[model samples]
Target: MRSEEEVFALLIGFAKSDERIRLVSLEGSRANPAIADDEFKDYDIAFFVTDMESFLSKDDWLDFLGKRLILQKPEDMELYPPQLGNKFSYLMLFEDGIKIDLTLVPISELQSCLKRSDGLLKILLDKDNTVKEEIVATDQHYWMTKPTAQKFTDCCNEFWWVSTYVAKGLARQEFLFAQDHLNQIVRPTLLLMMSWKIGAEKGSSFSLGKNYKFIQHYLAAEEWELLLQTFQGSGYSETWEALFLCQKLFRTISKKVALAYGYDYPNYDERVTPYVQGLHTKCS
Candidate 1:
């Protein structure tokens, strides 16, 4: 297995040696200073090049990286529409357990690239000096922002309102519908509330990392255990348990957020909870 430094050196060396590739930049976790360094962090690299299509035409060029366990070129594929917009990528995992997600972009698109970037970026090489300033990686973009009163109320309303859809789906025996409501709609707001609680505990200024991954830092041991329990959804029985846990977690987090920030939590006991309990009885 190549060391992280060795892999990074090779990536930079490759970019420096190629004239078509005028600049190189690193993004994602490697660029995020808040994230604890680990071997599993992927090398999210982008090469600012002269001609993206010229590089895409060749298959053997990528052999220099490593023996690919599997590779996915998103722009080259026909099934899913590409969101990259003028950028091409190689999502490659090497046989030696190293993964590198490399993207190719035309140098002409640098203006737009800077605007869309998540603010965690590091320049590795630049032959033309297209970048005017030094880049420092930070997780500032993923920080838990102080929510406005409207935003807080909206989050609470969304969590309590969408939850009824889960109850409706479960009563109708539409497991897929229930799963979507719980997973896609309600869960994100629950996660957001969790982040706000963490932010409140930590002076309302620190980041919770991407998707609130650092939330466990502020959570009590029993709360974290309960949060973990919410992820178990093997069957209908487990789905009910998961929904119940979501309600419990959301109630706990929202009250903390409301008290800290002067927001209002929905009346779960008088409204959604009993309605859901009745739906569960009817469905059973």
Candidate 2:
């Protein structure tokens, strides 16, 4: 694997040599001060260019980076529609085991990019000093936020409503359908409620990381164990057990959050619980 210094030097050197590449910035975890350095962290680089077309037209220049294990041009692919409007990105993994997510941005879109930035960006090179303000990268943009009353109610509603789909799927013995609703809808809603509770308890100043990946650090040992149990869905009985555990955890945390904020906790869970339990009994 290439050293971080070696990779960064190569990236900066390449940008300096190219006149079209006016500015370069590092984004994502590599730019965040709070995230511990790791070998798996990608070099998330953005090049604000005078002409995006010049870079988009050729792959030959990418050889300057390294030998690739695999490369994906997201905007160029047909199967996956491009989501980055006016921007193109290359996701590359080199044979040397270094990965880089390089994005090309038109100079015209720099202001718009800054507006949409998640506060995790550090400028590496800026020949023209296009960005006058100091760019200090922080994970603050992704921090947990206090939920509004309506938002809290909606989260509770979604969890209980979609949970019915899981019950329906399970009663019909459609394991995949049951698992999809459980994993995709019910659990994410539960996580959202859990995060709100965490924000209330721990202060909304810090994040639980993307997709709440860092949540385990904040969870109690037993709670984390229960949360893990919610993922077990290999069999019909296991899925039912996981669904019930999800309800237990979500209800426990969400009620605390509602009490802290003096918001009314809805009775959706009360109504949904017995309905799901009745289905479980019927299935058994």
Overall lDDT per candidate, in order of appearance: 0.85, 0.92
| True lDDT of residue 93, candidate 2 | 96
User: Cα miss at 200, model 2 (Å)?
Assistant: 1.3
Please give the range of 10 consecutive residues that has the lowest summed lDDT in model 2.
51-60
lDDT of 2 at 9: 96
lDDT for model 1, please: 0.85
**After superposition on all CA atoms, how large is the RMSD of candidate 1?**
1.5
Against the hidden true structure, what lDDT does model 2 obtain? 0.92
Badly placed stretches (over 4 Å) of model 2 are none
How far residue 217's Cα lies from its native spot in candidate 1, in Å, is: 2.0
Q: lDDT (0-100) at residue 36 of candidate 2?
A: 89
Q: Which prediction has the highest lDDT against the true structure?
A: 2
- Over 1-284, each residue of candidate 1 has an lDDT whose tens digit, in order, gives 89988998888888878889998999998888778898888999999999887898887888888799999988888898888988999999999999999999989998788878888898888898778977777767777778888888888888888989988887887889999989898888888888877778786655776666777888889888988888887777788889999999889888988999877666654588899889888877
